[model samples]
Target: MNHAMATPTGNAAAKITRLPFLPLASSAVAKPRNSSRANFYKEVLESARDKFTRAISFQSKDKDISLAKALHYVAAEDEAYLAYNREIDAFALQNERSDTSSPHDAQGFEAVENMPMDGKNMNEWLVEIDAIAKEVEAELVSRDIGCHLAEVLEAVNKVLFETRGFKRSHVVVDSKCLYLHSVLSSGSASAILLSVIYIEVCRRLNLTIVGSRVGDEFLIWPPTGNPEELFKVTSGRSLFGIVNGKCVDDPRSKASDINSSSLLGLEIATNRDIIGIALANLIRFYWKRASKTNYGLMLTSPLRSAHRSEEKFSKDNCSEMPLLRPQELRLAIMASERLLILQPHSWALRRDYGMMLYYNREYEAAVQELSICMAFAPEEESEVLEPFVEKLHLMRLEKSWKSSLGQKGRLTVT
Candidate 1:
């Protein structure tokens, strides 16, 4: 824990100290006479702490407390985004007040806003990764290891996998394997996360690491003119072993099995795509768990006409399943919301979000979101979503009527 304190200014002369592992704590203090700002800051701090607590206290099947720590990473990424925007706004304000501006200031702001918000939390993990990279660089310098791709790859592999014991986790669905922080702490991660770590470390070493998606898997390597030759040199493997669609097994018998055609067939994944993949995994895991519960299916079921008696909505038939905790469903919704932030125009994602909102019994929000989805969705998708939006509107009205009736009954009794 770094014991750094910020020098207070003007009316707000109270010193602010850093909290261990949480920079948001420093924002607890606010300018004097600004109650709204103070309240807002307080809310931010409390929300972050609550999220962190929930993440740490999450119960897992194997009694492992650390398994659900990815929740914290997700929350941290959101906080990082908010912090980034705050900084940009502050900088712009400062420039405006100073009456000094650069030719590209507005363009820079627009570019920043347009950039994908993937891996905003990478900076939090980079400090440790940068240290590890520095160690590898120092070792290479000492051993006279030049910047040859193979030599650098070998050194990085030894340091990360051998010395540090970082390896690919067999259980890809586990939350522990999906997040960078948990991966670093547990010494095991899924293929994508391991690739992310590798990419980050190589970035620190001034080596470029590019990723490509082959089927469902993300594989990364150094950029080279002769990719096949480089694959042969690197033995057609990465830190996670053979880079195949099914990352777990090595079915290739020889180096020649990795041909130029297969390598060229790989579709390059942008940073946004990688982060989307990770969130998509989380959505799958949470949704799968939610679906096992009795009421879970109803949340996503399409609203059918009253003429279709068999598929009609009925509250009597739906019962809460204790096994499917609300937190799990909420986590799935949170992941979906974050993914939507990255790809705001994705009507399919918006539809999913609206469905999840419906499941959560937020009928008004569900109707609003699904209506937006209808506007951008194709004709077929829009048709399918129409009933859902209408049903949600009806549900909202019914809820309001019930509340009003309850109030009227109370007045009559009084």
Candidate 2:
């Protein structure tokens, strides 16, 4: 129980306070001369510049929260990229203006550089979480809690579960449980999110809590302790064990037999892996919803044989799911893409992404992705993927041909 309390690391707000302002105007250096195309480029750059400037001010400072924010931005890549471009444009603009601007203008620009970015809507959850951790820390200090591993953990549990009322969501498909902000507000989250909260709060208290994926459940324990001893801690027994349906009656005897093997089987999750798992869960949830539609039917159905009815793609039999929400497919794709960013070389992930694109009617991109999968996927997987790749190529060709015919018909009408 005589555990040492580690030194507290600076939070996101503290880090933000130390970061210098981004030099926005410096990017306006290469102002394009007036022309239709140049005008378009100029407008785009200006818009992107403005958004990027705004986005930078709101970017999350905490690592895990930032990754969650990144997942949110995956579906909005166009906006994120525009914001990125804005940062570049601002610097160019500022550099161009610096030489000709008067002393007063220069002074004003310098003053702008010192101002902190607005911290309102974008990832405000980071601030709220920081506040939660601080509150826990203050509580522990005010009560004169010792640095014993069990004591600090009990204190954390009291603040989070009893006072704050955070609980586990029983519904497996609940999307709200997957998001950090939703979990914070709703007080119910999936195991991974709860573990994240537990880890983060403990981190602020100078304690280390590490997580492992045990079977389908994510379990956490202090970095240094007897696994069974820590498991006896009330929070561990109730919150982690019972919630996961792995609780045992007797502490020492049954706990050891059950957890001993689980302890050995535990695959320690890195921060990146945890984020990837969250996105994977989202992909699964969205895909489940999407699969009920004709457009997403391929996910549940077997691949069509090469000789199977050509009438499948005929005008009267076009694959369309009027009942399916397009947003669900897009979300599944975005979640898959975000997971890929964390694990780029995973051919299984690439294959899933390719399939999502195929269902979304992006045949060309699907073909490209599946082709990559075919190249690297295991021979067995490649055999399964080859048919999708071939079908996508045919679909791409048909789409192009139809487009050409439509254009010709339009010309004839004109």
Candidate 3:
């Protein structure tokens, strides 16, 4: 929307513009095999296709549409779902080697493992989390729970529920813990550690928790739930009771009092979202660190490093990152795009997207995207962009100034 700051041209246009979207057709379809896991994804894709087909039912019966348009419509509804399902399938195949032994001996056997359901009873799960917290408190004397932030989070995740047959919802941490990691440790490491913990905890507990890819915060999906209702769930709780980015606790309020803006917040999101935020935060963190030095070299180092690494991987016959690489930041960008689709007004997602573009070497486009992000930032964080933007402006200024000096020197020599 901040059209004043058009990108330096090229890919920036594609990155910032609201890409025109289209719908799919009904007649073209691809049937998937019926394995349980395959079938689950297949059903989702089919349902998406069906819903899209239904929406376009009014189209002229005699008219024909391209298969590409139909695919696009289905993709628009659920890009992340399709992307992740494909990743899951590819990973399964890559691990599926010759099984000369029993079915249990298969490397990909765990792909079909039943979803964790330890939290069928909320009371029981809560008791288990409490017990694990106590154990962690007790273990501080025996083992250093403060080795690495990720390790601490991982350890807590593993011991918290495995001992008591329960799992805590996304890794719970106070503002203090996040501040320590973000300020004291490496930004990427800190973001990833917290995100992994948050995600793994939810998985263990079978809770519908997500990583809030926006801020350095995490929350369970639904903060509250009814025990008596047939489909009652505590996960996926709306934060709509929050107004102007803060929660309200009025005694007169009912559950339904929460509004759309507050309740539908995307707090617990996917790993993709986490990675996006991490990348965004990393850019800001690096920019800040570079600003204090008053040198342009700092700005180029990390990006060049990333570019080199990306090049190395490509040369090694890997076009994309391997799943075993826990810190696949690219996945986070895709996740951020998904979040942006779901919650377009989210300044956080916009920030992440801009940062992603910046790292992807779409510098001018990155600046344009980030300019929009700066405009939407709350008053408190508005100043956060001033230094970074100034640095970019200064870099350009210095380059031109030096160029002029070089030209004048050449003229003098002549």
Candidate 4:
């Protein structure tokens, strides 16, 4: 299949290879500078000036400056900015095509806007939401829930469909389908399943459920409650509740293991983080498949081929803009930057950033970013990316060699 459409722009001479590598520095990353908001400005620009100088040196054709020396520096800071923009552009394009639903409509089902409400009464909101759920259950007719946990999903899906036209595929995408598949296929922990699904639906429905991170688990709290009332649902816990006609949890169920103030508040989860989480789960799940038959190749080959083919199909039939909604895409792009700043040493973030660059047609920049990523996180080099990079560099070398030979030939012929 034609990978041209999916591949970010550039000639064959700029790609970086995917290979086992060593850490450029280390794997440790500093935590967010602030708890509520990410102060990524300082950290993102946090680069060594020598790296920029080294990059400038590469522009020189002097024989004394070796290729390796030309490349060794703090890393290209300007390249990082260019790559960040490339990612934003790619994300915007994909989301435009995946416009299956609009997330902006704030009206609840049945024009619940004018519905009579007992003002300021928490009990009334809970009752109303349950009543809505019950009414939805009784009135709506739905096909069988085809998968596991299908019943709960069917009940909710019906509510969303009747209330807010939420399509199944959108629901699945918003849910951690990628992560769940990795977990189930790989047999890892099952903790994040329920929260992931709930959060996905909530986002689509504009229900304002905030995501939470607790210990090794994930959680969500409905926006209808005070932030203090948030619970531990993300941990795949046994209890759930409803507030203001929304499913939620009472604050009493908050995990004792967590600090009260540090709980993830009303802020929405960024698409980048969600995607990152999905990818991490995929890597972790496939970590143990070191054998030949059910090995890393087995896991990655199909995935890579499928991605390539899907990219080709999308290109042939349609264009890939961004895979996320516009506002969501903005948040993702910002979050990715924040992540890179906070976790400068994270291989996964670097690799993702590089991949983002590659898809955006910033080939040379992608190579540089990915090289660093490979250095930090060598274990998960993509076979496809590696060959692409090698081919790119070789092509450039060949072109230069051919140009010199042609010049010599012209002189000799003269």
Candidate 5:
């Protein structure tokens, strides 16, 4: 454990302190769900709750325990987090028709509570996702002779995105439904979210289609160029592995040994990376909301102008942003907290948390987090936080000055 990992994690309501964490499981595979998907989610939820209850009770029973005991407590907390997160995802499907707020509804704290991952919702989601995956599988299965990779690609692009009318959201990328249910319903998503859809389909089919990150752009494997080259790989570790079937990465093989065709530009996005990106997208949405000093002014932005004109406003929020202009930093703060939970050693995420604290006017906490971020950063990336910490100190001083002035002004008024 690093020095920073020892810090106790206090919630937003608690004073700023170090948050202790369990080592992230390299891969926490979801247990295979029964055909009864509803029961599967219910079982997961119950299991998580039982583990949480046991952890607390077990601690009480073994009060004078060792470090390992304390570790057990942390493990249980994480297990609960895993289950709760799934339950939370289901809430996204809640009456999209009734709660027809603008896709760009400046997500706040309430939105955090909306993502539920219960049995009922999980069943619906699996069915929807499978509906798309099954067709592609059937197509591939029918072709006993190897199907051309272009044909496979065309089938995927056609069924998932084109036929279903999935498109990248215009102007303001609304991340409201980038997850399973909402994405299927709205068919509007970002690149990473779409990649998830693609990846999931590939997983079902045992294909090796992966999400690739080349600089700023996110691309999926097997690019559209040169249709002649995209033959479906049979056995023996071919470059273009089956997308929806088993992942056959030659773990022992060197990069030099692998086929060049497998390389899709630079970095292949990991499962952790994909999940982290989704959380970051939500955080980005909230961060934008926090940055706005005035919702009235923001409503006038050209990005949202056409949307404004297209719809009539309800008496309450003008049907614009139901969750607009979060005055408190709750959503952003929560987002940063989740990011930290997911990617603890991530200096970049720590910096994001530091900035969130800065924006929330928790100057001391902000400085501490930035300091930790600086410490955690890799040697090559060490300078990333030098300028950040300096700016934070200056801001702290300025905040002190402002506080003094405010106190003096209040005294004078009195």
Candidate 6:
């Protein structure tokens, strides 16, 4: 078995450890200005700044400074995000634990218990989701439902779309749609998130449903197993497969089979992928916001329909545009960094991070990271990006030469 291609199919899959659901934790985030919390925040900020400055000036030579400090910041931010999720756990536990009033409130805890806390709390909103699944299951079971696959799928769809009112949103630039809490709260989510809801519900009902790409978007496919068998062997839920890098070496495979293994043999998006997607959504939010303000970074094709285009994302009626402001770019970079925290092995993530570094104008750092990306990227992707990466390398080389010349007091400006 190729080490990279080896998969934990069947029993071997059970041994893979995951981010555990720890006891509900607390956040040590700094408080508001003029308070004790403010002091802590200021101290941390100062420490990070000091580290950053020393790293830049090569004063301490203790830490590589730029990469090290950025990673440290990412680590701390990752912890804070987990803490935020813990808060959600506590909230869900508190709200849905004691309440036997509604089936959702009653079973919500079970759903929360089922999902491991992995720095995100869409699971916190999942208790009600569990309740809905049980309710749907109970109703279907009561109707003496047969093992007809299409009928079962229709039932699942009706319960979710009509009864629960779960629907897809048109907003590509809204980060709120990515959060399960926000989705349940708003009764709307993006295609991916809504598909998540569908998959979760079906899985709870012992359906072997999976989310697969349909066109440029994703949808939950119906189960392939026997309904009775699904009901019988229900105890633990399977972990979603991780997309550590390119989804597939060959894009051709993706067009033919949506369930094809991703790099690292990830058959589906893991919790890390979902979190990465959410963070990417945040980056898009800022990008979209900046687009409206007529300033942004990279641009994409126009929306397929007006219904989905929350921001016009247009200026000269062309589908593409550039609109990154410094602050917005920073926020996007931080989100991408957090995604890297969640998925360290992701080559695609490293590529995005390197591009973000370029957007931030740290040419040398960008080239360094992108150089690593060259080793991991698909052959075709590498070919397409080769010229751009070379240009960045050249820019960094010239920059280093100028600095060295200035240090020698031999720099001449023409």
* Sort by TM-score, top down from the best: 2, 1, 5, 6, 4, 3
Q: In candidate 6, how many Å is residue 265 off?
A: 17
TM-score of each: 0.65, 0.65, 0.28, 0.29, 0.49, 0.48
Q: For residues 1-414, could you state the per-residue lDDT of candidate 6 as single tens digits?
A: 222123233443333223221111111232332333233333443343333233334233422222222323323343334443344445555556785332122113222222223333433444667777887777678779785655556567667777777666655655556555556666777766666666667667767555444344553444333323322212231112111111222364342233322312324554334444556776676555644566433421221221133543222221232444655555566566555555555667777777766655567667655555555567665554455555456666677877898889964699
Higher lDDT: candidate 2 or 6? 2
lDDT tens digits by residue: candidate 3, 1-414:
233342224455345344321112111113434334444544444454454354334352412322222222333324324433564555466457554322222123221111111212222333433454555545543675554332343344445334432321123232222221221122222434343433434444333333343333333232335312212222332232110012123333232333334545544444334433433443344344334334443323332333342432121111231122122333334334434543455666676565554444334445555565655667544445534443444443555676789877855443
Please write out the lDDT profile of model 5 over residues 343-378, one tens digit for every residue: 777877786677666545566677677666655666
C-alpha lDDT of residue 153 in model 5: 60
Tens digits of per-residue lDDT, candidate 4, 1-414, equal: 234212333343134223322222111122332211112212332342233233334355433332121111111222233333444444455567795342232223231122222231223333433454554455334543332232443456455444534222212322123333222222232334434444444443335445554444455555434444344343354223321112222343344434335544324544334433533443343232212233333322322543363443221111232232232222233334434543456766776655544433334555566555544454435445554444434433555676789887765343
Which 10 residues in a row give candidate 5 its minimum summed lDDT?
106-115
List per-candidate RMSD values in Å.
Answer: 17.7, 15.1, 18.4, 20.3, 15.6, 17.3
lDDT against true structure, model 3: 0.37
lDDT of 2 at 157: 78
lDDT (Cα atoms) of all candidates against the true structure:
0.57, 0.56, 0.37, 0.37, 0.49, 0.48
Would you list the rank order by lDDT, best first? 1, 2, 5, 6, 3, 4
The count of backbone overlaps in candidate 6 is 7
List where candidate 6 sits over 4 angstroms from the true fold. 1-123, 141-151, 225-285, 290-328, 338-349, 362-364, 377-414
lDDT of 1 by residue, 26-91 (tens): 232233232333334334434544544443332432123222233344645444334534544555
lDDT of 2 by residue, 1-414 (tens): 001111113452244224332222223224444323333333443443453333323243334343434433332332233333454455456567976432121112121112112222334665667778887777779889677666667678778888899886646666677766667777888877887788777777777777776445667777544556544547446333432333233343233334544665667777677777777888888887776645445551434443245524332122642345555676677667656656766878887787777667777667666666655567766666555455557667778998999877854443
TM-score of 2: 0.65
